[model samples]
Target: MEKKPAGSSLSKALTMLNHVCTSPVPLRFAELVDLSELPKATAHRQLNTLLEHGLVRFDEHKQAYYPGYGLLALAHRTWANLDIRDVAAAPMRDLWSSTQETIHLAVLDDAEVIYIDKLESPKSLRLYSAVGKKGPVYCTGVGKAILAYLPEAKQQDIIHQQNFIRHTEHTLTTPQALEGNLQQIKDTGISLDLEEHEIGIKCVAAPIFNARHQVVAAISVTAPAFRTDDASYETMKGLVKSAADDISKRLGACD
Candidate 1:
């Protein structure tokens, strides 16, 4: 039997943590072993270390390991420190005030759209999603808009890695289908979520670019299906696009 160096063991543990961070649910020990290609005993030892350090936690009932509360604390720290939030706050407020629809600001994390900020609509019949909620990059408007503008290799990598889980009848579950939709979004510079991720919610989204002309985030206006008729969709589409453009310009994205 051969023993790995301390540095190698630490690297493997970090690799396992990175894999779990992107997953939607906790993973079993066997799953981690297979994914990380580590010996079962080594994986177990690493898991125990992570658990003790509050970097990972075990679910007794589910028999799976997931990221611990410490990871969430770290995520909060990162979010609070990022300059994008400061750059986006004023524009986001303006978008919310003008549309009166639920406006969301999301960034890409592990190929998924992670909502960092949200402004709920004041209307009685408005659609709402939480700030910390994560959704597939293929079916959601914000996700698609950002993904469409990403580098081709990165987009392919994400499509290949993620399961593309179908949440509703309208969800695009296949890579080819999603690719086609992304192409359409790239062509039109707009994205739509027509009851794709959620059955009764629709969204209009546009990409926010950074100083390097890279799509760094997305802005969206979500509304209930009943209020998302053709005319309203068109109107909101233009509005969201304008807001995204404003944010991008502020971020120094130019022609």
Candidate 2:
């Protein structure tokens, strides 16, 4: 039997890693084989390589594979290196004080939205998500807002790379529908969560541009459903947009 090419083996390993990272829970070898579309022997070899590299680990009790400490270490380093968190701090605080809602700053990473900063509202009933949490780009307001302004090729690449898993009944699961929504967000300069990612959380988000006028991040205000009636939603939308615009301007985005 001929040995597979190095590129082919590397591709299989990456596919397996991607499968483990995307899943909400650990995956069994069978699951990895099905998702990666690789032969059982190939999958085992790739998984073993990943395990040796500390990119994957197996749970003995459950007999499932999960992302290993290597990924978490890399993620931590990446987050620390990004200056967006420092740049967003003052504005996030202002937004939090003004809207009295949870404020979040998120950036697009590997086709997902990763929260880098957050300011919790003082109110007892506020929505509570944390920094470093990852959310689907098609469902969360911050994700959609940034995605709306991304380059067409990058957007299409992300759409093609991942399966649109519906987190809730309201989640947009089809590529066409997501594209339509992105168009609307680009036109309006605002995006809405609408309880798509979480049942009771509603968020209004807008894009944050950089010195080159390219959108590099998004800022959002999230509140519970009970506090976000039609009128309040509109108010929060305007506030979130204004805050995002101010931050963009601070970063030298104009027009």
Q: What is the TM-score of each candidate against the true structure?
A: 0.66, 0.66
Q: Return the TM-score for candidate 1, rounded to 2 decimals.
A: 0.66
lDDT tens digits, residues 9-51, model 1? 7898898887777788789988888888787788888888888
Local accuracy of candidate 2 as per-residue lDDT tens digits, 190-214: 9999989889889899999976678
How well does candidate 1 score on lDDT at residue 134? Answer: 89
Clashes of 1: 0
**Candidate 1: lDDT of 46?**
83
lDDT of 1: 0.85
Q: Model-by-model lDDT, in order?
A: 0.85, 0.86
After superposition, the stretches of candidate 2 with alpha carbons farther than 4 Å from their true spots are 1-82, 125-128
Clashes of 2: 0
For candidate 2, give the lDDT of residue 149.
96
